[model samples]
Every structure is written in C-alpha cells, then in structure tokens.
Target chain A: MIKKLRIMIGTNKKNILALTFIFSSLLVLASTQFPPWDVPVEANDLENPITVDKKNLDAGKAFFDLSCKACHGATGLGDGAVPSGDFTTKAFTGQTDGAIFWKIQQGRGLMPSFKAVQETSLWQAITYIRTLAAPQEIVAMKNATIVIEFDESNSKKLITAKVYETLENGEQAPAKEVKVNFFIKRYFADMLIGGSNNYTDDNGSVSISFPEGVPGKEGKLQVMAKLDDSGFNPAGLTEEVAWGVEKAAYWNDDRQLWKNNDFVPLWLLISFFGVIGGILIAILYVLLQVVKIRKLGVGR
Target chain B: MSAETTDIQKTGRSLKEITSDLLNPIRSKKSSVSLWTMLLVFIIIIGVYAYIYQTMTGLGVTAMRDYTSWGMYIGHFVFLVAVSLVGSLVTAILKLLEIKWAAPITRIAEIIAVAAVALAAITIVLDMGRPDRVLNIFLHGRIQSPIVWDVTVVNMYLLISVILLYLPMIPDIAIMRDTLTDRPKWQRKMYKVLALNWRGTDEQWRLLKRSIRIMLIVIMPVAFAIHTVTSWLFAVNSRAGWDSTIFGPYFVAGAFMVGAAAVIAAMYIFWATKPAYKKYITSKHFDMMGRLLVLTGLVYLYFNVNEYLVPGFKMQKLDGQHLMDLFVGHEAPLFWATQIGGLILPVFLLCFKKFRKPLPIFIISIFVIFFAWTKRLLIVIPTLLTPTFPIQNVPESWHHYIPTYYEIAITSMTVALVLLIITWFTKYFPIIPIWEMAKENGHDNPHEKVVLDDIEKD
Candidate 1:
C-alpha cells in the first residue's frame, strides 16, 4: 500500500488550519462591536407661542403635575426629592417663553413627549414654565455663590466643564477659572471648585464663578454640560445645559455621549457580508487543494 | 489526434511526402466552410454584436437594479468560474500524481479553464456600476469587501492559468518555429514569437520544468480563490438565501461540477471537428472525465444537502421562506429544475458506466452547464429581491429584476469573445500541446529524434 501511494497536494493540513485560524480571528474582530440600538438627539428650536387660556393653563398644570412636577417640584424650584433643576433659577430667564414652550412640547432629554399629554395641556405646560425664576434671581445669600450644574438625567457620567464671559454675539470665551457642584438625590457634597472643595449653602447649594477679565464678560455668560442620549429619545436624543458664567457657567464634558450620534447603525450589514466572503474564499482554497489531491489519486 | 496519422499509414506511402503535399493547401486558404461550422460561427457573431450593444449602453441596459446589483451577469460569471475549476483536475491534479491518462485531456481542460476564467473576469467588469473606476478597487480597496478580495484572487488565477498554458507550449512552439521546412514565412514568424528563443538546451529545459512545477504548485490555491471569492461575493451579503456558512464549499463543488461539464462539452466539440483529437481524446478520456464529474456532482449534492436540508431542518423564520421559494414556492419550477437537471440528474447519469460514454457525457455536460448558470441566477436574484426592507420602488420591474436584451447580449458577447480568443489561439498554436503529445508518442517524428533521445532519459 505504501509503495503505491501518490500524493499531489497544494496545501497541507497545517496550512489549511492556519488559514482557518486567521479567518476566524478576522470574524471576531469584525463583529466585536454590537450594533447600536441607541436613538439620536439633535438641536431643536421648535417654538410656538400660546394664547393665555385658563383652561389650557389648567390642563398644562394637570400635565405638569403628571410628569414635570416630580422632578421640578411643585414650586417650580430645584427642591424636588432628587434636587432636580430649579425651574426658578437665573438660567430660567434667558430661555424665552418660546424656548420653554418648545421644551415642553418636545420634552428635553430624559423626558418623554407631551404629545399624548393632551393638545391643550401642552400649551398649558408652557404657561407654567413662564412662572419659573430666572438663574439671575436664583442667588443663595448664605454661600453667596451662584451654582450651575449639568449631568445625565438617568445615570450618565459627567463630561467636561468650562466657564466663559458672555458676549453680545452669544459666544462664551473660556474664563480664567471654572468649577461645578455635585448632588445625587440630596447626597450633596457642597462644592467642587477648580481643583478645590467648598461647602454649599445651609440648604445645600454649591456656588460656581468665572474670574474677572474673562473676555466677553458684559452681555451674558453660560456654563453648559453635554448629556448623552439616555432614558429618552432612544433613537435620536441628547441633553444639554447652559448658564451664564457671570452667574456661574459650567459645561458637562458630555462630548462622548452626543457623539453617540456619529456611530452608524447600518455597519452590521457590512460585517455580515464580510465574514461570509472570507470563509468562502478560505474554503475554496482548501477544497482546491483537496481536488488536486483527489485528482492525482493514491496510485499513479 | 493519432487517428489522422493512421489514415496515410494504411497505404504506407510516406508521412513526409504527405506533409509536403498538405503544406500548400494549409497556407493557401481553400475556403472549406462546412454548413454546421458556418451556423455556429454566425450565432457566435450575433452573440458578439449583442454584447457590443450592451457594453456601449453600460450595465444600465441590463435588468439589474440597486437592490439586485448582481443578476444574470454574476450568474454567468459564477457559472464560468465553476466551469474553470475542472482545469485543476486534469492539469495540476493529474500531473502531480503522474497519471499517464491525464495527458490527452489536460490541454483541453486547461484551455477551458483559461477561456472561462478570462470571460468570467470580463463579465464581472461588465456588471460593475463604474467599470472605468475599476482601478479604484486597487487604489481605495477595503479588504473588508469581498469584491476587493475577488479582484486580487481572480487576477492571480488569470496569471497562473496563462503560465500553466505557456510552460507546456515551449517545445511545441519551438517545433512550430523550426520544423516543416515548407511552412509559410508569416507562420514561422508567429512560431518565433511564441518560442521566445527556446534553443532547447539542458539549462533551458531545466528552467522550463522548474517554472512549470512552481506554477502547478501555485495554481491550486489560485483556482480555489477564484471561485471562493466568486461565492463570497454573495455569501458575504445579508440576503435571505445567500447568507450561508456552507456557501464556500457549496460554490467550490458547484464550480468543479460545472467545470467538468465544460471539459466534456469541449471534448465533444473537438471530437466533432478535429477527428485527429478524437483519436487521442478517446472514449476512455470521456469515461475518466465522467467519473470526475460524478465525484464533483456527489460533492455538490452533499453541499446542497447541507446548504438546503440543514437550513430546512432549522426552519428558522427567514430560512423557511427562503428555502420554500426554491423548494416548493414561486421559484419552484426554476429552482428545482436547476438543482435537479443541472446537478442531481447529472450526478445520477454520470454514475453508470454506459451513461459515461462520450456522447451521453457531452449531452449531460451541456445540460449541466446551462442549468448551472441558471442555478447561479436563481441563487443570487431571488435572495436580493427580498431584502430586509420592504420592496417598494419606482418601477414594477425594479421590484422584479429582469435582465434587458442588452444584458443578455453583453453576457452572450462574453461567451462569444471567449470562443473568439480560443479560436484565434488555436488557428496558430496547437490546441493539444505538441511537445507533451510528442513525448507521449516517443517522438517518432524524425525532426524530434535528437531532442527526445536527450530529454526522454529523465
């Protein structure tokens, strides 16, 4: 039997094994990232003024009682159980009634639509937003520091922060110093200033400030925090916060979260085809060798 | 080709005298066109002109659409690639094993491989959306795409096939250059270019053998890549039926099956035309090719079982409908016919000793090649038509891709073009490698006596 055996092979078992290993590794690498099911968030300026109808206002109150009040608190102050945004802050005034109206209609990040909240109730909710205090009036006399905060509504890490002088053109140039406070459901750590720590007001309020000589100081300043799409528009959603620096500007380094938008969802299709194409070629090469061996036969 | 040599020997007049007498007739153009030859050539020309019209209008003239970007053209290319796979069996496979019977059929198989692969590459280009930017495939190629891999592998296969064809032709070309003292001056010049300064020295002979051995070694992998890449072009896509793990082997087996069929078909054409080749090609050659076909068919059948039956076993929501479309559904007629007529029937027919006869094998091969081409079309188009997205479109035809007249014409052109290339080469060079043939016959010709005596010892 040994004397009669004839072998004419293109690839040995080892070579085929090596090729298979390589393709397997490529498949793993190609499919490492799972396709995203996350929604997207975009800049929306949808504003529509409303008539001062008491019925709509009452409906808005009912709607607000159902959704917004739990976080905003009954007084529209940052006194909710979670110490959510103080609707009655200096930040509140800069946003026009239209902006507020838009916010109520579209619902900001972490918030669901009021579209089903009743057509009249949506306008009513805007009427209530008007009563909230502007950030300028949100001064805490005890610590005498204006506070600005931005973070994820439903579990997201803080991103980046910067303070800047407010300009007439709405550009906020970076300031000399910047700081932010922390409050996780009343577990307040008074304040975390620029590389330092200080306590907030007795009622638990931390203050933020922009140093003097910051370029655009005159008109208005802002502190903004970028929020990723979380707990809301699962498909297309993001959260942002902006406040005047003279009044304590802050920004969340949430660039990563908003950038979640940049990741395309259609990439899964590409990888699926990629793996298929790879295996076919690998097997073809292997089988061709087999065919060669088979054709040559055992006995010449 | 030995039968022609015997015709003169019955009289024992002298082959040398006959050769001298035939020389004038060969050079002079006596205009011998049989009716059948005329008809075949006429059809070939029609296919050529139709293809020309398609090339001018661009792939848009085809029935393909954005969703079904690969329709009949890919279908044809896949079939061609499959058909080319038979070359490995006759050439690399047989030569490696030192099989004596591999000699007569090897050149025929190799020619088919070269022609089919050459045409396959052209068909793929014709299917491209931007054929002019084909260079972009190299410049900005993402190895991620199967298309890029295909471009690399097919080009490599093309190179290997040419080398395989050329190496065996060196001595033959030398003979064409030096032998037959009364041959035309232009014929001698053609032989000189083909010979490339072959003085047939020991060193030259060693170099030729070494190069051929290297190519034979290299060609198996290249051949595999050509068809696998062709299969991957579909396997990689996320379509219903096309998304299969077994597709690579499935395609390889299919390629071998069809390629063997192509070889059989070509053998018959030679049998009917040359009479000389029929003597050497022999019924035994057909029997062997048929056995090889049976093997390929069985392997393809096994793959089909895995490709279809295993998926059917799962009956996953998607796989169920996809298989049904071919099994007992809308494409039932075409799908089953292609699978049965193209694959299963050929396997069954090739199993018997009687059915493996040259004429029967030839008939089976024709059926196999034609059905295999349609099978590829069935594999690609149906899966594409039913994408993940609901089918809503600008035109009804877009929803149901049907190749236009131009597509069919262009496709036919590629076929005709392949034949045209083969015809041109055969008009000059021997279709059966003369040197290899002469060696098998012990170089009885007086001109080769010294060369054969020197080389035959090895």
Candidate 2:
C-alpha cells in the first residue's frame, strides 16, 4: 500500500540544475530591476539656469548669501569664517551667463527652487556661483625628509603622486577638482596647519614618493590630493590636516560604496504572494466558521 | 449483475444465516490490567491532557514554527475528516443504489462517520494558534478564508450525518424498548425515549426515506466542500505543491479514497468481533466495500496524476523544492509509501475477488488507513521544512519537529476517543437497521424475526 507513492518522483540532475539556474537568474533580476530604495533626487534648475535682470541679480545674491554663501564662501572660493567647499557643479561651470542667471533665479534638487526669491536675487547668486574656484597660495609643509616603499608581491596595482603647499594657518588648503564633498563637525578645531595639493597615479592607489607641498620649512604645509572633489576651500574638515611625507601612504581599493538591498527587493513580491495565501486561508476559515456558528445557533 | 437476479439470489440465501459459526472477535475491551481498548484509550487520555496543556500554553507546545505554522493537528483533522466521508459511500451511495449487501455494515459506517467527523472538529480547533481568539473569527468573519469554508461544510456534514444515523434507528429503538424481554426496565425506558413513539407507520417510513434521500444528496456537496476546502487551504496559498489548480479535486478524491478504505477497515473489525453481528452483515458486504475501495482508489489515482504531471511539466521555481521534497528528497519514503501502501496496493489487492473477501479486505483497510494518514502528514510537514529561507534563527530545535511524547499521546487519545464513541454506540444499539432490514426482506420471515429478536432481546 505504501509503495504506491514511490514511483517516478525525481527529476534528472540536469533538470534540477536548469531549475536552479532559472531560479537564481530570476532572483537577480527581481532584486536589481525593481530596487525599492532608489530615492528620487531633483535636478531641474540646471536645464534653465540663466536670469537676465540686474534687479534679479541683486535679489539672487541676497538669497545666495542666505543659503549658498555659507557653503561656497563670501568669495565663492569656499573660504568664509566657517568655510566650505565649492558647489560649482558641471551645470554651473558649463552654463552660459544667461543659464547661470536663471539657475540662481531657480534652484534645483537640495537647492530649493528659489523661483519665489526675487528674480534679480536669483540672477545675482547665479553670477557668483559661476565664479567658483580654489584660492591660489597653497601651504608649504614643515621641512622634513620622508621615505616611501612599493610592495607588489601581493597587490598588482598602485597609485603614486606628490604634493606641495605654499601657505599656513589662515591660508587654507587649495581645492583640487571638486568632484565630491564630505562635511565634518567642529570638534577638532586645533589641528589646522593649512594648504597644498597632491596628485593621483593611474593605478587608483596613491603613493607619495617625493611628496612635498604646504608649509615648506620647519613649520606646516597644507597639501591637496588629486582625490579632492573640486577647488573649494573650507571643505568642512574638523581636524587640522598634518603635513608630512608619511612612508608609502596608499588607499586600498574602493571596491564599492553601495550595496544592493536583498530583502527589500524581494519584500514586495513575497508580500504580494503572502497576501494571496492569506486571502485563500481566510476565505476557507471564514466560510467554515460562519456555517458552523450559524448551525450551532440555529440547531438545524 | 441485474438487481432482479441479485435480489433472487439474496432471497435464496436465508437472511437468518449465522455467519459467526467460524470466527470470533478478539474482545475489544480487556477485562484486566490493560485492554486493547484501554491502550487506545490511555493514549487518547494522554493526548487529551496534551491538548489541555496546549490550550493553556498555546500552540507553542507543538513543533510548529513560522514556516510550518499548520502542523500535525490539521493533518490529523484532515485525515479523520476524510475517513468520515466513508459514511456517504456506505449509507448514501450503496444504499441508494439498492446494494442489499450493505445491510450489516451501514450502522457501523454511520458510526465511523460520526466519530471521525467529531474528532475532526476537535483536532481543527486544536490546530488554531489562538484558540482563545477563535471567537474573533465570528466577531470578525471574512468570507475569503478557506478555514471558514471548511468550518461551514464540516458543520453541515456533521449535522446531516448525525441525523442520518439517528433517523434510521427509530424502529430498532422500539424493538429495544418493548420486544427485548431480557433487558432491565431502565434500559427499556432509555430505548423508549429514543424510539420517539415510533409505530412503523407508512408516513413515518416515507418521511424517513425522503429525509435520507435529501441528506444523501445534500451530503455529497458538503462532503466535497469539506475536503475541497481543505485542499484550497493549501492550493490557494502560493506555496509549492499546495498552489496547484487541481488540489480541490485531488483532496476530494483522496478523501473519498481514504474514506472508503476506512469503511473497509471498520467492516473487518466488525466481522472479526463477530458480536452477534453476522446475521445482519453478509460476506457480500465485504465484497461491495472492497469494490468501493477500488473505485475510490482509481479516482484518487487520476487526481494524483493530474496534480503531479501539471506541476512537473511547468517546473516553476516555487514548486521546485516542494516537488523535489516529495518525489526525491526527504519526504520521498513516506510519500511513496502513502501512494503505494495507503492507496495503490490496497486498491490492487482489493481489486481481486478473493482479496475482497471479508477478512483480507478488512486487514487491507487498516493498512490503507494508516498509510492514508501518514500521507497527510507528509503533505503538511515537508512543505514546511522547505520554506523559502535556509531555515535559521532561534533554537535549532525550531528547524525540525518530531512530535513529542505528549504529542503522540494526545494524537492517540483523539483516535481512541473516537473509537470509544463508536464502541459505546454499537454495544448499545444494534448496528443493523432493523426497520430497513425488515422492510427490505419484506418483514414476513417468522424465523428471521425470531433470530433478530433473540439478539435484540438483551
């Protein structure tokens, strides 16, 4: 009697493998194609960044000083008392004066569309934003000799570069390409030596072989690395950056900065199916219960 | 086999013939320290205790985890319910078709129907995680759930089944009241109350017949609903083996199949006990039951193929592990055993004339019932073991569930409790419907009346 169920229940190994492949592919597709956490970022202002009126420029400058100046600085070199890095994005640099004026007239993304700000004020901010760049005299480092080494037995790639500085304390670090910005709180205020620039090698690793820049004597130098986002000062670092050629300083590979969320992607699909399952069980249970209770009450 | 010829042959064979001449029943209840009945009863008591413990502790006592929320209780409930459907085959199907061979066993079949359905109800309640919150169901009833459908149909089936068993017993109750001289006065009163002043009038008989007919017709759909809803509980879920479109019919066929097998097992037990019962039941009864088993098996087999083949062809990702688990993975042994031992072999064995004979048919029915039940267990447990995640977290014990000692005790208790109900009912009431039998045999046999009266007398 029991043997009746034993027949032909297994699929061939190859079939199982094929099933596994198909299932995995579907899992990948489901996770990637319909990601749940891609939060929307607005960037509409750049499409039309120009504003024409002189009155609008003044108004734009007022609005800019209220919001943008703290980040881009009074001179837009990002060197205010609290100074920040420049936010002269590609749209700002590439735009015509008219476009820049319009951008000040209307902000985009994190920049609230200040279309409400006077059109003149919007144009003024745009004109200022168009002039975004790093200040000139980078800091020179304290006079010091440094050693460096390259080890390739384990790793196959490395980046090599050097930097020098020309200024101290109030001089500030000159910004490089200004591609990215990171903000730091004011806890480490006593550590500033001040400005310089460093460069990057083709291999993505940075090694300062003859690294020299900033505070060039026995004092301090502020050197900038090619890894800088753009030429903006006051890039919101709390601690004063040390000026020295530390031996063989390099960055490990930046494998990836983001991870694809697994559970959330599958959540919607699972929930959809789960609800369906719940509905089915619910129906069966309710239908039966209603009849049972009714029968029990009615006694017929 | 024309009914005319069958009736003539039946007439030639005296209705008063004693079948107990060659065999005797192993007394169901032991007189001493432990009876076979008590063992089943003890297990049942422990099981009941376990149930009480569960009700207090909540469904946490069972090995059910998040993945396999519905566990052995529901499986047990489903098996018992399937067994309950056997009554329809005996009382409704065979009776309506005028299969005179069913005479001796109809009463027994009815008892099985009542007992199994009753137990099924208890077990389903046990299956609920929040039995306390069960009232919330009525308070907040939803038509969408399969559980509600099941509760509805099962209640209807139970009501109709109990009434079916009772209505046919009126004339016999009267016989117990007045004609049984050896019976004490109190017993007579009890019988009189049950008889409800029945005088065997033509109107009463007509009403009885009409009601039985109505019940039989009504019961068919209700029976389908109980099992079909059970299937939907699985099928509508987007789980692997459960998501099949064919589950409704599959479950129904399986229910009737297992049900027929249960009837066969009960028939054998009745025959073995030989409890002054053979005069009422004949060898032809066994043959008819065997035939019924075969028919159900074939229908179940058809559904099984539809269930397996469609999923196998599609090979969807959701169904992958579920199919593998049943067919080739961990559940394989039980799966195959249920198919072959529970369903196929009994069907094949009972297919033959000799195997369909009383004793062999009866023996095979037990195997079929055991296998059928295990099949239900496999259906539920394996799906849970393979829930989408690589099952992790919590105690490692959460990953697996072999029912605890107390769990088995409670399960056995349910089975024994059901058996006890059937036993008491049969011991007090003559299992053969006297009024129906007398009517069928034309009530003119002085000798047949004498022999039947001898048993009815006490």
Candidate 3:
C-alpha cells in the first residue's frame, strides 16, 4: 500500500513541476515585446545643418549640460533625470541626427519639447550626442592610431603614448618623431601634466613621468594623450592610474568618516562599553550567588 | 501586614491548602493538545518552511528595493523589542515597589519578554540579506554606528532578562521536582537539574532574593538602553520622522505602554484557558494592569503629541512632506485610526471603572497591541517614503514598498514561533511561582508540603 501511495505522489509531483515550468516559460516569452516608438519618415532623410567642427561641438556640449543633461544624462548613459528606462542603448546612437532632432523637438511622456532651442543649436547638440557612444571605442583612422598606457606601480607616475601609422595593406608601423601631449584630466578640461609635448622614440612610444604622492579626486589620476589636429584627424585616448588611496588633500577638512578621521566620538565609546561592562559584572555576580547557594545549604 | 493574614482574607484557605491547590497545575501540566495548539503548530510549520525558502532565495523574495530598504520585518523587530520591556516593568519595577497584586503576573510577563526578545533577534536576522555575515558585526564592528550599540544593548538585555526569568523560577522548579511525582520521568529529571538543588533553606532564599534584587535593579537600565539604541538606529540617520531629540524617551515610554498591554493580553489568555487559575489571576489583577496601562498610555500620548503636533503646528519644509503624508495622504487613514481608535479611545475607555473589567480591558489591550505594531510601521514607512532628496533614476515601483507573500509569511511565522515557545514553556512549568505563593501564605519552607503531607497521614 505504501509503495502504491509513493508512486501516486511522485507522479503528481512530476505533473506539478512540469506545469510550473511551462507557466514560467510562457511568462518569459510574453515580456519580450517592446513598446512602439513612432518616428517620422522625413526625420530619416533630413541632413544635419551643423558641421562637426570643434567650435560647434563645444557649444553643443555646453547647451547639453544646461538643458539636456538633466534627462539624457552627462554621457547619455540613460541614468539621468528620468526614473525609468535604459537610455544608453545602441538605439540611441543608431538613429539619424534628424531622427534624434525630431525626438528632441517632439517631447514624449517625461521628455520635454526642445523646439525652443534653435535649429543650429539642436544640430550642434546632435553633434555632441554622437560622442556619447562608448569613449573606449577607437574611431576609425586612415592615417594614424593613438594608444595610451598609465603605469603607477612605482613611486612615480608613468604614462606611455604610442602612435602607429596604418599602411595600405592594413599593417601597423611605428610612427617616429610624432609629438604626443600628455595631460591629467580635470573636472571640465585636461590639465597639462609633466612634459606637455614630447616626440615619440624610434619605437613610436613617448613616456612621461610625474612625481609621486600627487593628490587627485577619489585617488585616481586620469592621463590623456593627445595628437593635435595637424595632419590626420586628431586622436586622443585616456587611462586612469591609482594616485593615493585617500581623498585629495584640498578636501582634508571634509566631514567624511571613511577619509582617515576619527569617525566615532570618545564619549559614545565610553558610555557603550560602560553599560556593557556593568551588565556583565552584574550577571556574573548573580550567577556566582546561585552557585554559592547550591554548594552550601542554608542553616536552621 | 502579614502575608498569611492577607491570604486568609483573600481565599479563606490556610497556607497548606493554598500551596496544594497551587501545585495542582504542575502535577496536571500535560500537553492538552487542543485545536488551537494544533493550529499554532501547523502555522509555525508553514512559517518555518517559508523562512527556509526566504533564506534559500534572496531577500529579493520580498518587494524591498533601495528606497524602501526596511519594511514589515524591521517594524516587527522594533515592536517585539518594545513588547519585551513588559518583563522589566512587571518583574523589576513592580518587585521593587512590592506591589502584591503584580505578584501572580510576573511569570507571564517574563515569559512574554523572553519569547518576544528571542523572536525580535530572529526578526532582525530575517531582515539581513546575508545572515551568515552577522558575525562580521562583532569581528569588525565600528563603535561609531548605532547598529553596534543596538546589538550590544539587545544582547545584554536578553541575557539579563533570561537570568531574571530563571532566578525566580529555580525554587518553583524545585517545587515541581519534589511534588510532581506522577509526571513523566524526563520532565521530573529536567526540573531536578534546573532546580539546582534549591532546598528552601534560609541561605538559599537569601541568595535567591539578593540575586533577584540585583538583577531587577540592573535590568531596567539595560532594557531602557535596548529600545533607546533601537530608536537611535533611525534617529541618527537624520530622517524626518526619526530625527528628533525626543525619540529615545518617546520610544521608551511607548515601549512601556505596549509592554503593559501585551502582559494584560497574556494574562487574559492564561486566565481564559486554565479553569483552575481564576483564584490566582483574579479580576483585581486585571484592574491593576488596566491602571498601569492607562498610566503608561498617558505618557506615550504625551510623547506622541510632542512627536507629531509641535513640528506639525508649523511644519518645516523637510518635515512638511512627511507630516502631510501621515495627515491626509496614503497613510492618513491608518495613522488617524491608530491614533484615535487605538490610542485615544482606549485611554478614555480605560479611565472608566466598567472598562477596567477583565474582558473589557482585554478587548482594549488587543487594540493597543495591534496599534503598537502598526504604530512602528507608521514611523518606519512614512519617513522612508519622504526622503529629503528627490528620488530619481529608479522605477516608479521603487517609490512604494509592498511586502511580498514570502515576507508576510515569514513575519507571521515569527509571531507563531513566539506563541509556540510560550506554549512549550507553559506546558512543563507552572505559569505562577509555586514557591513564592507558598511563602506569601506563610509556608516559608516549601519542602514542608512534601515532608508534612506524609507525616500528617501517619
């Protein structure tokens, strides 16, 4: 009888488990459909009015920081003024400049209408928006490539910059005597650090060194190598190295507890331990009294 | 002034007869296995299963996200700690004051305290995402954090409360060991070991009295410290509802109120279940508990006024949103109902002589206990929702905290576990102090009942 009951229970359990699996798979399939995002046909064909020049990009960045940064985020990573949605998807950059312009002009849901900003300014914003894609991706270069390496293991800050020229058959050859400018990245702009301009060696590498114990925010020194816009499109890359594992010295007066200050007050320590100690002693005394009573019986 | 004389007036029974009647509970203390007991066991089993599921699954089984980091579990933690303070109030404060009416209720109060505090510890563990990392609190604890202080005081309070509960029960355990001859052998042996050779000698009585007195004196501050430190956990964070200089005393006063109400509820339950316990836990005991509840309630009411109304009168920008939320927003109805129906109506009703009757007091105390728990939720949830900085870059779902099915099941299990612990304790031991009642009736040497009963027959 028990064997028959066990078989029945086991089969029922199998059926239940199978049903649960099917139900969960159905839920997974149902959630894959994306919501419709309507776009105008004219937006795809409209040409960008603003040129991708240095001056226009800078103005666009300034305007983006003022207005669009609140919603679209600083790097347009979708972590912005909005509470929902991943705005940093590839779809953000996949759209044409005109499509992005139309989206900006026509606000949907939480997005506000940006028609208030003029056409040239909007186009410039779009130019800046193109740079919002992953900064680590090397822009395709016909002539040269810039690579930066930051090494901070030793007692000195070392930044190695190398430039390579691409031949017609797609082979990389070292480009000697190329001037590389190394800068430490700051809040708004990069500060020229150590040798601002140094020519690469025969190996196509330029190494710049700075003194140890230099202070930086959050214990990081961002080293940037720039090949200025002289012949080919100016190429630059940045790499961060550890400085000191402490906040910048200028922020020493900050009230942050983790930054090497006495986090706890002395009085709090005394009061807490004092209470604990008193309780411990009292409990000890009580237990000892119980033991004493048990060991020696009371007299008549 | 004679204890014997008072017993004669109260029950018209001599010391010997009274002691025999009192010992009846210990002799007859078998597991009755009622429907209620069975139901509690079933629920407890389900609760344990839920907790295991929660542990295997992450705390994500609950709907708690970044914004609503704390939910019902924390509220229950604070509530349990608050309710546990009744042990200190009844056992220590009343003992020191020598209130004779409070004598019968201390064991019940202590049991509630032990059960609530033990469960309060578990409730906190439930709130942790990684409960195994709990040892890290001790390994690398920063004395700076209120969390460290909370842990220190809560542990201390638990130790002191347990010792206080045990110290008084030793003589009673000895009484059970000697008198309950027909009880199960294991039970008798358990009592024998727990009794620690208590002989009712003068030295033993002196030591027990001295130790109890010392523990009673020591436990009060530790009890105060536990709840005060609990309050600081929130108050130190600078949250709107919690960031007040008055939170420590406010919480302590509110704790006493809830603790008293919890004791009254337990007294009523015990009074209802044990048909033989009517003489010991009389309506007079309920009357005294009612007055005590009212007294504590008035103090809690005063703190509640200071907590809400003063800032509420001229609401500051930071305090405004929190106050409005409690006053007229989503939480307004529950908040107002808890305050008026739970707090004010009970206080007003308790002032009347008719309401102080056992059944009426029990009903009101039920309201008080219910409100006491919801009151902690009000304090925790509203302040969290109205954070000083605007919430950005999160889903709208993160804005509201709704406890999931698993969280609710686990919380309910903690309550059931507390009841189960209390149930198990009441099954073996006498709920009232057998030896203390004998001594109060001038049967100072409790061993005489075992020795003299056979002597009288011979």
Among the numbered candidates, top TM-score falls to 3
On lDDT, the candidate that comes out on top is 3
lDDT agreement with native, every candidate = 0.61, 0.58, 0.77
Docking class of 2: incorrect
Q: How do these models rank on DockQ, best leading?
A: 3, 1, 2
RMSD of each: 20.0, 25.8, 8.7
The number of clashing residue pairs in each candidate reads: 36, 106, 0
Q: What DockQ results for candidate 3?
A: 0.21
Model 1 agreement with the true structure over A1-300: per-residue lDDT tens digits = 222111112221223243333432333233232343222233234444566543444445556666777667866785553334567666665555555555555543223345445545666676655544531232211111222445444444232333343444766443322223222111232222233332333333334343332222342323322111111111111222322232224433333322222332345335545544564554455435433433332332
Candidates 1 and 2 compared by lDDT, better number: 1
Give the C-alpha interface root-mean-square deviation per candidate: 21.7, 23.0, 7.3
Regions of model 3 farther than 4 Å from truth: A1-156, A161-264, A297-300, B1-26, B29-33, B445-458
Q: Which stretches of candidate 2 lie over 4 Å from their true place?
A: A1-300, B1-34, B181-186, B444-458
Question: Model 3: which residue pairs collide?
Answer: none
Candidate 1 local lDDT, B133-179, one digit each (tens): 88878786654566776877776677678768877776766655565
Which TM-score value belongs to model 1? Answer: 0.57
Give lDDT tens digits, candidate 3, residues B1-458. 34534444464445445546666655665557878778887666656655665675567567677778899999999999999999999999999999877888899999999999999988889898889999988888877777878887887888888898899988777766766778888888898788888776667778888999999999988888899999999988888888899999999999999999999999999898777678788999988899999999999999999999988988998788889989998899999989987789999999998999989999999999999999999989878888789876454567777776667778888898888888788778778876567556555544433323422343
